[model samples]
Target: MVVAVVAAGGPGPLINGFGVDTSCLGYDAHNVAQGDADNTSHNILHTHSNKSRQSSPGKNFPLQNNSIALEIMVNVPKERKTYCAGKCKKHAVHKVTQYKAGKASNFAQGKRRYDSKQMGFGGQTKPVFHKKAKTTRKIVLRLECKKCKTKKQLCLKRTKHFELGQKAAASGHQY
Candidate 1:
């Protein structure tokens, strides 16, 4: 068994494949020695050790489970011009609006079925999913052609917040 010991800012004792005491200068020395031993282990160990040195704190380091506040503000116009597949096959002026989900129906087929199953006292009937992965939903834009009044839906990239139009700019001179 090859036991590799890694420590910060100190000369550490390492136990190699053979059961013997080996003194390593530091991580840099180990990287250099491993690089000379084999090409594969050299590449793997050498590149892996240099990443933390390459990266610093507060420099766009991506966190897997943590939520980051991007604080991004978006500005979109209320109207847009694009090709309409309806009556206007050519480019036409279109009105842009944010799309929203409708309210859940109490009499929907799935809802009715689930309600019927849970009518009697049986604790819980269906499995309630709790493992939510995403924190944001993709924003959908509703585009309506001004000429033909034809509407189409456009999906935007996911974001925490969505804005319809640009906010009013502040005047330079105050009254």
Candidate 2:
């Protein structure tokens, strides 16, 4: 989800909303001098929101206060059409799978240090995170080229319910 801080006047520059800056593109000294900055600023923001919505089409990120909530699609298909780095000349069909993290090795420096600290009979050596804010994790798609067998990963937006390969019974359904 995108984190946006709203000021008393209007939505300030986005702290981090898909790494996009929410600052009004039409802002300039001329507009402010003519006293038309406020009027044009909101229009520019609406234009930016339209472009963002069109770029993804699936995810509707909020840019202005009017567009506060929008449904997010979390279902992914088994196959995807993405650029292949290996043998394909251009965009080609690829096999899509959910990316999974491998198990961490016990011999890692952090693991070893944690083990030693626990053996010394300390109740809690490290600070445990309690105030969890985010409720969803970003979904990663592992794409493999059909011809060259090349693999690439793509990170997607965070969603409460994520599905891979099969369609979910209810996801962003307008009903």
Candidate 3:
């Protein structure tokens, strides 16, 4: 009697012999390397390696488990446009010149109209004073792109309106 073992989707029988029982062969047990066995499955053939597989040309590969995808924004230059304080325009306003009204006060007058107790002059006559004239300043606006050496004027305001280091005129150009 001839016995044959046929494999599923296989071209030929796995084993065939005359005068033999196919049931005696049983199932072929797979051997795996150390740490190759799957913890959830007892079957040796179901074990998988921990190493990641690299992609080869002309091969369809599935995404790996625990992979993260990211979206990035790219800046492209077309017709250069400018964004102003609250409006967008075809040509950006190079400079916004702000003319502030001059402040007039007598605080700067050096005239000593009154003497304090700390001055030690209880009844001395007040000394004559001279006031320094206030001066005006001109600020230039500038904007530049770090990647490209392109620059343009932005906006300008009186120096008095800004604090030290807080002045937009003296602030470095932002890309």
Best-performing candidate as measured by TM-score: 1
Tell me the tens digit of each residue's lDDT in model 3 across 1-175.
Answer: 2222322222323322222222333322221112234521332222233356776743454432212111111222222345533333234533322234567544544423333322664565554567856443434444443334355553433233332223234467778
Better of 1 and 2 by TM-score: 1
**Model 1 TM-score (2 dp):** 0.56
- Measured with C-alpha atoms, the lDDT of residue 137 in candidate 1 is 74
Worst 10 residues of 3 by lDDT: 66-75
* Clash pairs detected, candidate 2: none
For residues 86-135, write the lDDT of model 1, one tens digit per residue: 99899999999998889999999999999999998979989999999987
The residue-by-residue lDDT of candidate 2 on 1-175, one tens digit each, is: 3232222233344333333332444333233323364654443322233244344533454453322222365678888887898878689999999889999999999999988988866499888889988766777899999988999899876666677777656568585
The deviation in Å at residue 174 for candidate 1 is 8.8
Clash pairs, model 3 backbone = 94-153, 96-155
Misplaced by over 4 Å in model 1 are 1-70, 168-175
Number of clashes recorded per candidate: 0, 0, 2
Q: Write down the lDDT that model 1 would get.
A: 0.65
Q: Sorted by TM-score, highest first, which candidate order results?
A: 1, 2, 3
Task: Tell me how far the alpha carbon of residue 42 in candidate 3 is from the true structure, in angstroms, after superposition.
Answer: 99
| Every model's TM-score | 0.56, 0.54, 0.17
